[model samples]
Target: MGLLLKTLFYSSGFIIVWAMVGYPLSLKLIDRLYKGEQLKKDYSIQPTVTVMVVAHNEEKVILEKMNNILELDYPQEKIEFLVSSDNSTDRTNEIVTKFIKEHNERRIRLFEVILRKGKTNAQNEAQKTVTTEYLVMTDANAMMDKNSIKELMAAFTSNNIAYVTGRLSIVNQYVNEVSISESRYWDNDLAAREIEGRIQTITAGNGAIYACRTSDYYDFNPIQCHDSAMPLFYALQGKRAICNHDAIAYEKAGEVIKDEFNRKVRMSRIILKHILPDINILNIFKYRWFSYFYFGHRTCRYLLWLSHLIVFVTNVFLIKESWLYAVTFTAQVLFYLLGIIRGVTKANNKQLTMIYYYCMTIAAQWVGVYNTLTERTKPFWEKAESTR
Candidate 1:
């Protein structure tokens, strides 16, 4: 039992260290290899692209979404908008139908699917209708910059590129201190750097805007989360799925603090059940970076403050044996705990509110794991306006 515990401590410690060091090292290596390289552009041969949106009860902002897509700079003849209502009870379908009817003469092809389920079902239903060479999946609330489609298409210049993901900027930063801090967590911190560098696996942002070859796209089981499963499945196929820094889509963050917590819970459960569990061991060996990302970016993030406990207990034993080991372990635990504390407190004007927010995120992850393991049923979408 002592030997087993020691092995767990050592393995967990090495995994934590490798994850931190590997992220930057992977960035540096990819940058060195792809130096002076830019996305290849092919203006002469315009490939057909379909912009697919899966929405439900999004009447409040569905029109804004359509208007944003309609304003993209891509060729009208080359772009198609495949809109699915996903069994919306609100005026989401009616609004989109009216827009499509009015703009029928234009190049946009707007189709609706009314399903009694979540985004995964809507996306899978829309997949059959995509007749274009490439398909871009985006959320109803996701706002595309004028150049987003063009930038996404440029990455497809290499035939080996199976999919291209985008960066998300939270438009409603002033919503709340928690929402604002969450936005910064992505925009100002790790996400921005991950997108800028090459050989990306998974990124945490809107999960709203991503493009892929129509042939390469797979159906995510309705129970599965689209963002978590799709890219991971693509990775298993040994194809390059990239993150396009220039492909920017802006979206509103959660309406309030509790809304943000609910969102994290849903995301955490999906990552644990679908993404981390079924990953092929051989593929994990090949893309060890992604393996680390799965654990660091998704899995261990839930353990939260308990990570400090693990470090303290394990190192106390190692302390008498080697002072260097003790010092190194102490520094790592202090740095991460500090980051977590600062991240939480920064959510509001009060010094301690950031701590509350940090604990909230961590607690939400545990709730998610519990719900996932016990097979608890939770609604896919939340009534954010009601939360406000």
Candidate 2:
């Protein structure tokens, strides 16, 4: 029993450390080896593309999003906007309708739902209005760069490329401890996705800005996260999904830690319930490079909380075995203690804030796991108030 416990402790510790530190270093080291080749521009190629924006009570940012889309570098004649409102009680529909009237162009269309279905349902209903060859799916709150659409379309140079996701830039307008840590998280995520895309198909797309072939788009399960579901669906069809670093969309970070935690918990539950089952397409024997990228960038990441828990619990059992074990156990306890302190006091230290965020995120994932096991998490979407 003692031998087994010690072995488990060391093994879990090694994995946790490797994931936290070594894995990122490895990616950076091998980044140049798999760097994606730049595609030559064909100025004469103009594909008809539809931009779909799904909103529920998004009156705050809907107008800005519309204006952003209208200003995109893509040809207005070749591009169309499909704005869907999922039973918005607020002025969301009215605002979109006003925009359509003001534009007075056949390019802008609005689909208002009377009943509150979920985002997936709204997206599916809106997709039927799309006659374009390419689809650009974006959130109402995310504003795109002027050339984002053009950059995304440029990647569709080959038929084998099923989807192209844009870079998500977390704009911390109101800088605070939570915002700083959240920015760091997004930076790391973007880096990993860039590297993964260079190596092979990326694990998923940023919900803010992503494009896919209209023919390849499918109505996903309402319970599944659209960002992950769409990418995995394309992968299963033997199509490649790449991220266009040049295409950028901006979004605000969560101002409050609790709001971010709740968001992550919901996301974790959806990933565990829906995304995990679809990962079989990334079989090592079948899809060699993609399998390595997916497991390294996503699967192992999802299981990190479990690895952390194992290390902590096993460390407790081996605390008195040696000075090294005692130090390791003490460090774990102190790190958690600092997290609690940062939570209660709301300290501004970047390192402590990151640790607090990490611990809270793990706690949130545990709750998400419980919700998944009990089937308590529903398909309905809840907007994080802090981000809004």
Please report, in order, the local distance difference test score of every candidate based on alpha carbons: 0.68, 0.81
Q: Which ten residues in a row have the lowest lDDT in candidate 2?
A: 34-43
Q: Tens digits of per-residue lDDT for model 2 on 184-276?
A: 877887787777666667778878999988888898877776777876677766787888878899998889877898888877876564425
Compose the digit string of candidate 1's lDDT tens values, residues 224-339.
Answer: 77565665676666665667777888877775677788887777665455435655523656865565555555455544434545655776666656777678677767655765
- Alpha-carbon deviation at 55 in model 1, angstroms: 1.3
Runs off by more than 4 Å, candidate 1: 1-45, 107-112, 188-197, 200-206, 278-285, 288-347, 350-354, 377-379, 386-388
Estimate the lDDT of model 2: 0.81
Candidate 1's TM-score: 0.79
Off by over 4 Å in 2: 34-43, 274-282
